[model samples]
Target: MPEAVIRTAPSPTALLASLDPLLRQWLPRRRWFAGKGRPITGLTPVAVTELPSPAPDSDGAPGALTGLYHLLVRVHQPPAPGSPERPGDCYQLVIGVREVPPTRPAPGLIGHVTRGPLAGHVVYDALDDPRPAGVLLEAVRCGARVGPLRFDRDPGHEIRTGLVPRRMTAEQSNSSVVYGDRLVLKVLRRIGPGTHPDLELPLALARAGCARVPAPVGWMTAELSGDSWLLGVLQPYVQGAVDGWELALRELSKGEDFAAEARALGRATAEVHTALARALPTVTLGHRAMARIADGMSGRLAEAVRTVPALLPYAPGLRSAFTALGDLAGQGRTWTAQRVHGDLHLGQCLRSPDGEWSLIDFEGEPDRPPEERRMPQPAVRDVAGMLRSFDYAARSADTPVPGWAETCRAAYCSGYARVAGHDPRTDPVLLRAFETDKAVYEVVYESRHRPDWLPVPLAAVRRLAAPGPARLMP
Candidate 1:
């Protein structure tokens, strides 16, 4: 148990002023930081709360030297020319303060604070420290409230305290800590108003009796300006489960066929989509809505070509795919739209030791705005993302494996059709357009981040953009 101490919330003005210089240098370097390539002009404090720390030392001395704080700060960056001015992006931060730096170097050491109430204290990311991480879980277990911050847990769930914390390193857009292999806590780095799908979707699926997703056991939030901002969520950890991406690559390297696993994954995805539809609102898109969606795809392609000259050659073929969808809509075609995984790929799935597949990370594309990510879309959109993932896995191999990706793609669609009551392949144009759009997104992302890896997605682009009767199905 932590020490019971009464600490007042730090003054917003002094807190932001003291941390401004350190954050300007530290925030962009984080893997979860979304404002890369942009200079931060300033930071404004949204809320601040003092956090609990470890109990007194063994010698009956006070542990006043250690401090923890939860804060929400809005990062200001210059928008593009002629763009309307709006509030900058807000981020959730857990900061730790100590009178002295650690004996051994640790990750997330921000630096020594030179001003404000915390002057001369060494501050680091609290998530990187075990004491602070354990405090967060304890708060959830007790539903502790600190000023504007709220930590609540589902009363039906039992969360054991004093569990060891180990931060997950593979996450790119969020920070996660696993507690004694029992629960995993995902801390949202970027925050916005309204209900976040990461929490909302999983809870909805749980209520609908969906077993394919881990239900939330606890969560943290902040009430600000009449809106609740999700700070983090806690879910049961699947012990000894391997992510689908790593499993796929291992199978590909051994020349083993992955049709069975792919089929199971497809089934799992369909189950999630069905549960979401049953538990949430569903809408049928008319001709105009379809045209607007198609236009967005076309617009993204145009932007990609402008950013990556390598995409220029395939621009015409890709444009045709989007144009086909628009033409179909122009003829009054319509389709059902329901809540989905938003972004579905091999990396977003986990396979248990017993071979059960489970979907994770419903946050969708982290780069997209929250509202856009939460929008209902055709379920085939997720199917296209997974198909592209199969191709990616095959291409990542040491040598090209002929028909490997095709077999997995076909088997996946077959499995989905069995549960969905309709074949995704039945609408070749919609699937093709979605797949093309996903490939184009990959091209842009890889070109900017990993030049050598650009060829993998570009190969898909060549095949997807091939001039033909529109390669409908795998």
Candidate 2:
């Protein structure tokens, strides 16, 4: 971690100063920490706010006095290896201060200190502690406005206080707390200035009466660089919901036909896209716009090629797909562009116990900048993502299931055509290009994060680049 940039601060100086020494040690351990393997070069506080502390709630044991702090710390990463690193990422840290540490081993503990005003105090991530979680929930429920951090609640929805908060443990880039089975609060760890798409998109879908998405009931925001950056969001909890990824794996094990489920999911996706088109501004994609889109795909592919030397052979074939894209766009073909779930995959979807399919995580690709996530794109971008997900799922099984992925892919397209009035298959060029681009991205990601899974995307790259049914190579 970088050296502490601030030795002192304003309101919460005492508390902030105490945590500075431990932040570096604790941050890299969390799953949400992005700059793993890379050294953090700098650390500084961009914004800090104090949230109202509720009177300690005693559940048999003696209640300890606790202080809650909302902090936005900027973490800098060294650019080395394959790609250039972001200048830095601002992370939101919710810390709870106490005089005594937890009696048992806890992952939340920042550390015990003995050098500052908090010499004898214990600091921990507040979201992992029930006491501070209750207070944070109360703030969201009452729409408490604390300094630049404003908490707001949606109409027709109310929150209940003192519902012992339970932090969700899952493979996600954000932190989440579920309150007594009624609502779940998702805290965005890596923050970007301006309203986050996760919050902005769902609210719009809710307004459009789209039931596929869980409506936002409450949210917290802070100002960064003169624009609002979303800190956290609260929505109704999907009780007993099994995410599509798990459900698909189960089906793959059972050897059950999943084409029907895939079709229904396709229908649900179409419904969401329709609602989004009506609720948000729409634009038309001309030749120039398509050229820009192709360029972006090519750029990402180039980055992937540089990082994964294994992808170098497929680079020329991938470029051919993008080249064909520009040629098609030059033919005066224009497509409609509107808001879409920028990141759509099997993991982004959930299947409720009652047999309903719902989409989650509208944050888009967390690695991409917020501005890019907000840009209007063809709805097929999401279609291609889901299709690629199905392909990945098929390969994930111990033995690659013959025809399973193809059957589901065709069914999903047919279902989408039922509602969308146009079949995604008819536009093979766009779909192939998108799938190729997505596979390229996955190759790089898996190569970096999951070397074992790297072959999955590598197989996709070969299929997409070679002369095949789905290949778009010129």
Model 1 scores a TM of 0.93
Tens-place lDDT digits, model 2, residues 1-474: 011321223545565566767887888877777777677666777787766554564543442645667899888878535677556888999877777765532538888866666677788888887766777678777676677777788868978766878888784789999999889999999997876789999999998999999999999988656898898999999899988888888899888889998998999899999999999999999999999999999989888877788999888988888888889999999989999998899899989898999998999887778899999999999999999999889999876668888898998889999999999999988888888888888887676556789988888888888865555321
Question: How high is each candidate's TM-score?
Answer: 0.93, 0.91
Model 1 residue runs over 4 Å out of place are: 1-8, 56-65, 80-86, 103-105, 447-452, 469-474
Q: Give the alpha-carbon lDDT of every model.
A: 0.86, 0.82
Consecutive 10-residue window with the lowest summed lDDT within model 1:
56-65
The C-alpha stretches of model 2 lying farther than 4 A from their native spots are 1-17, 57-65, 80-86, 103-107, 470-474
lDDT of 1: 0.86
**lDDT for 229 (candidate 2):** 86
Q: Candidate 1, residues 268-358: lDDT per residue as tens digits? A: 9899999999999999998899999999999889878876888899899989999999999999889999998988999999999889999
* TM-score of candidate 2 relative to the true fold: 0.91
